[model samples]
Target chain A: MSVPTIKFYVREGLLPPGELTSPNQASYGETHVQRLRLIRALLDVGGLSVAGIRGVIEAIDDPRRPLHTVLGEAADQVVPRYERGDGSGIAEARKRVAELIEARGWRTYEGSPAAESLATALAALEEVGHGRFAEILDAYADAAERVARVDLEYVAHQVAREELVESVVVGTVIGDAVFAALRRLAHVDASDRVFGETP
Target chain B: MSVPTIKFYVREGLLPPGELTSPNQASYGETHVQRLRLIRALLDVGGLSVAGIRGVIEAIDDPRRPLHTVLGEAADQVVPRYERGDGSGIAEARKRVAELIEARGWRTYEGSPAAESLATALAALEEVGHGRFAEILDAYADAAERVARVDLEYVAHQVAREELVESVVVGTVIGDAVFAALRRLAHVDASDRVFGETP
Candidate 1:
């Protein structure tokens, strides 16, 4: 990164400034480099705005925030939020989301942002005349549980809480992009075998 | 849906106009109602721009495009595209993507947008100091394959080709959101169980 870009991150409070070596010059340490990399990943890969990046960065810097709180904030920044419309479809979708948690025997908060995100997607599927698509919910939930278990198990070995938090935040955000991309590739592969064609 | 909303979809070429009955009134049918629902779902749920919806509507109207092409286009519109920067990070990322396809024995297109999307995501993970995250990718791929098989099986039973296309398009777009939400929920559950805490 250029000096100007580094200074810009400093101005935005996205990166802490290096130690002052002289009146007008500072020496950046390894931590600054790490922070810059994180800022880039959150912006470029996670597609988070500067404000969203700031929110998660704050959470990361604060040790008092519980693991769940950090994870939720990280998810909030990554997942799309809505100014939800008051429609019957949404109401039905919300009910289905609640039932999914119950049916799966998950202890996740029924009203979490993730739950609302699921509801919005469900409502959209219903509106699109693909209401039957919900039949595959259990299948998707099953797959998701497996992946999430892999995720937690991977992070469990990190000795520092800071590393664990960083792992959770980065994993939650970029992990979504990773899984979505893999799912699309899997679709292409499956469709080819089933339909006897190639892309 | 209101008259003006329907009129807007027609104006945007997202919905076929109703059959003309008189100069001031056109008789709407079941198709119009269904199209309106699709428009609503695409706009509100899929978060597609009007132009994106127009593109998909045109594809849905044209049977000349094969299933793979239409599916690619649908996936293209849903996945976030990038003005990729020429950096060593991205170059390495692309190499890993090709390796993943080869290792998995997938016959999918190497340069498909979905593949590029995955590459971008992996690159981002590398950038954020979690290159090790890719180690768990096979686990994710395994889960994705299961879900994709379920998806193909569900859509295969659709008798009509148009219905199949519709199912694939809606499933690809909304399914990502659904899977993402479920993954977060699963994380919440797994973290609670492993850490002995509640959100």
Candidate 2:
């Protein structure tokens, strides 16, 4: 990173200021290097907005925030947000998501943004005339559970608290893009099986 | 759905011009109405750029593009794009993706952007020190296949080719958001299982 870039991250509170060695000189340590890497991952690989990156950094720096909930705050902004007008099937969609959570017996927090994000997506599917897509939600949940297990296992292996939170945050956000891209490739494979070649 | 939005879509070449009954008294039929819905869904739900929606419309309008290829075109831009510097592990990632495709016997096109997109993601994972995350590719591929099959089945049931194409395009983009949101919620559940309540 350059001088200006490091200064910028410092201004944004994304990184800690280096040790002031003189009126014009400063020194950074290993923590600075690791934070720089995390910031780069969030921006370049995760495609997080400035605000989203800030949210993740805040969660990390806040002592009051629980370790388990840190990634959730970072993730809320990292996931694309959405809304709908009245009569847009949003109410019913929310209800359905609520039922899925209840039926699954998952102990998540109240009003977690992930639930709303799922609801908004379901409503959007309905508005697009593909409400039937929701039928496959169970299958998707089953798959996602398997993935989250893999992810949590990776996260659990981290010895440091900061390392564990950062691990899950990166896994949750960038891992989304990874899974989505893989999904598209798999679509090509599945399409070939179902529809065959253009010829 | 409003007049100005409809005109905007027409101006952007996303919707066909209404038949000019008079200088300012053009009449639109069922096709226009359907096209309008698709435009809204792409904008509000899919979070696609104007350029992406235009790409989809062009694929729909062009005569030479095959049915199997249309969604692929729209999907390339819809899926997030990424890149990396030299010695960033990208070359190795690309080779791995190619091997995966060949191993799976998927007959997708040469240099398909989706393949490149997947490579970029895997490379990013490595750059972030989560290269082992790629180990779960088979699990993700399995889950994605199930979702894609369900998507194709719903698309196949549509009576008209136009409707079928629109169904798949809408499903592909919006479905990405839906699945990502679901994955996060599932993570919360998995976290509870692995770590219990944070005390």
Q: Write down the C-alpha DockQ for each prediction.
A: 0.67, 0.63
Q: Estimate the TM-score of every prediction.
A: 0.90, 0.91
- Each model's fnat? 0.79, 0.63
Segments of candidate 2 deviating more than 4 angstroms: A1-3, B1-5, B28-30
Clash-forming residue pairs, model 1: none
- lDDT string, candidate 2, A43-112, tens digits: 8767788778888988977767777787687678776676566577778888899999998877776457
Q: What is the lDDT of residue B136 in candidate 2?
A: 77
lDDT of 2 at A120: 82
Q: Candidate 1 at residue B187, lDDT?
A: 89
Query: Which lDDT tens digits does candidate 2 get at residues B1-199?
Result: 5789788878888889999999989998988777776777777767788888999888877767667777787688686576456567878998988887887666665467888777877887776677887777777777777777777777788877677677778878888888888788888878766765753
Candidate 2 TM-score versus the reference:
0.91
Report how far off residue A161 is in candidate 2 (Å): 0.7
